[model samples]
Target: MANVTKLRCNETVRIEQARIVALYAQLGQQAAERLMASAIEDLAMHMVAIDAAVQKNQLGAFDDAVTSLIPLARQVGMTKLEQVTRDLRDCMRAQDLVASRAVLARLMRIGDRSLSEVWDLEDMSI
Candidate 1:
């Protein structure tokens, strides 16, 4: 019997806490909270679009969704989410279905983690 090792494909998802704190400092707590809430809502919609595009194998739509997600991800300090989205975009642009699918799976995982982290931060006052 050939010995096989399982490879863990999950990437570590993290939010840039300092950037979020800086936003709060610059914009005041109430305004920063509002902006974060809006960004989170927008990101959720984009995630849905990305999932639909991937399901339909629509590369252009997938690319577009990722493109829209990048700035929002960055603004909210979703570092891993932004990086995975970029990777997914590159795969879609190359027309690599297998690679794109892999990246899409990673993106979904990171997106969920990122949202949870943001929610945790939202519950805390800076």
Candidate 2:
């Protein structure tokens, strides 16, 4: 398997962290920030376990971690961030169906069209 680090990627993690920071700003300077700080403390506390699950290929455990982040993202009103987290969770839950079988059909159709165009070109000596 590819490195677990490739799963979230630095960009996604940065977006997640930025969403948390934006939530902090939206919640105000002191009191709400303190509350979110506490939550971050909790997430940090569990980080090792979450990372371990990801590294060990424990899909359920990894989903649990991604799931845990959603409420926190929602609390901050980071809807897109929340959606991305949910997508990751759903992919883990669905496994094989993550891409859905229909995409294969679509690609095949596209390939067939391209091949047909090639045949026509040959016939035209183009």
Score every model by TM-score.
0.88, 0.44
Model 1 steric clash pairs = none
Cα lDDT for residue 108, candidate 1: 88
Best candidate per lDDT, number? 1
Q: Write the per-residue lDDT of candidate 1 for residues 1-126, one digit (tens) a residue.
A: 999999876667779999899999999998999999999999989998998998898878877888899999999999889988888888877888899888888888899889988999899877
The reply for model 2, stretches above 4 Å from the true place, is: 1-29, 41-51, 96-126
Error of 1 at 42 (Å): 0.9
lDDT of candidate model 2 versus the reference: 0.47
How would you encode candidate 2's per-residue C-alpha lDDT over 34-84 as one tens digit per residue?
765565454443344444554465877766776676675456343544555
Where does candidate 2 clash, by residue pair?
A: none
* Residue-pair clashes per candidate: 0, 0
